[model samples]
Target: MIPATETPVCEAAGVRVVRAGRALLDDVSIALHAGELLAVLGPNGAGKSTLLGALTGDLSPDAGDVRFAGRPLKDWGLGELSRRRGVLLQDTATSFPFTVREVVEMGRAPWRRTARAAEDEEAVDAAIAAADIAHLSGRRVPSLSGGERARTAFARVVAGRTGALFLDEPTAALDLGHQEDLLRLARDRARAGDAVLIILHDLNLAAAYADRVILLQNGRIVAAGGPDEAFTAETLSAVYRTPVEVIPHPVTGRGIVLPLRG
Candidate 1:
């Protein structure tokens, strides 16, 4: 857990976003403390991606601001921000035929100066090993299986060694085994004092991994709290417009959800 004296890693206050003359997000506020794993959840068109873009500096909010360590995001230099936060988009495609090692090494781009490059290299090697892709390092990215490719992408972000990580549907293409592996890695990162924010479509996965859940609906935040507080059947039904059941996980005791036919 982050020390009480340290400021929140990231915070958004009354954030509002508009795209193409349409309101995509409205008056959303969130504070992400260090070492917590937060899951952003909602149905399609809920503006989850837009919210992430605002957080990662990809999109500037028309109203309100995004602050990092109490400083406006705009005030932070690009390289400085990259070193503090790593982002993984939902659609990651590499058209170039690069080796997995080469792709992972790209994470070091933000720290290419001074002695940081060497430290970045060490971090890359550690990340590859953690992702269990050391053997595939020499393989071409395009030649790998879907799961292997996902792992490679994950390794690349982990190699960045940022204090905060934002992943949008990172496990979408992975099989059950690989998905579990990735979640374990995410948990480890949080345990090691990194703030991880992930957008997940799978309620079960979110319940299993996230310490907090923020639910959105119609481009607005509908619920935000821990799994027990936010993953109730009523909240799920209202957010997704479908009846659902929240059950206790047999092992982890976390809230697990199941769809119910009306």
Candidate 2:
């Protein structure tokens, strides 16, 4: 976990987004610091995606502002922002019939004609291996399964080698094994001094891997703190509208959330 004393790599201050008389995000404020994996959790329509978009400067807020590296997000050039952050959104589709390798290679576009361009091939190779998609590197994107396509998109983000990462429901289409692998990789990235913000539906995964978590409901933050603080049974039950139990893992000491079942 990053110290609260450290300055954040990304920050949203009093951000609000309204669309067609509905507020998607209401007075939401959050920070993403280096060396920590921050998880955003909520049920459907909680504005998780909207928060991600606001933080990444893809969606402008109707009020307040966002900043990266202490500078306003609006001040950064698109190319410079691309170099500083990599985003892996829900959609993982290619416009053309690009191979997995080609899609991953596109990540290096921001670094072209620069010194970092020399590392492109090595970065792409490493990202492919890290995502375990080397086997599918030659396959066309449209030919791959949903999970495989998600992994390919992840590999592209990894290849970008940005200082900060935003992944929205990255594990939604992944299987059990790949889901674990993806979170582990994201945690590893945080440990290696990158700021990672991921939107997740799995409470246990967030407890296991995230350094901190923010819970949203009705387009506003209901809780924000360490896993144990935000994943309390009462808080979760209230937010999810379902009774749940929180227990500690025997070995890791992380919370294990289970819904009540007859």
| Candidate with best TM-score | 2
Candidate 2 similarity to native, TM-score: 0.98
- Stretches off by above 4 angstroms in model 2 are none
lDDT of 2 by residue, 201-247 (tens): 99999999999999999889999999998899999999999999999
> For this target, which candidate reaches the highest lDDT against the unseen true structure?
2
State each model's C-alpha RMSD to the native. 1.6, 0.8
Tens digits of per-residue lDDT for model 1, 101-202: 998998878888757687876888998998889999999988988778878888889998888999998898899988888888898899889999999888
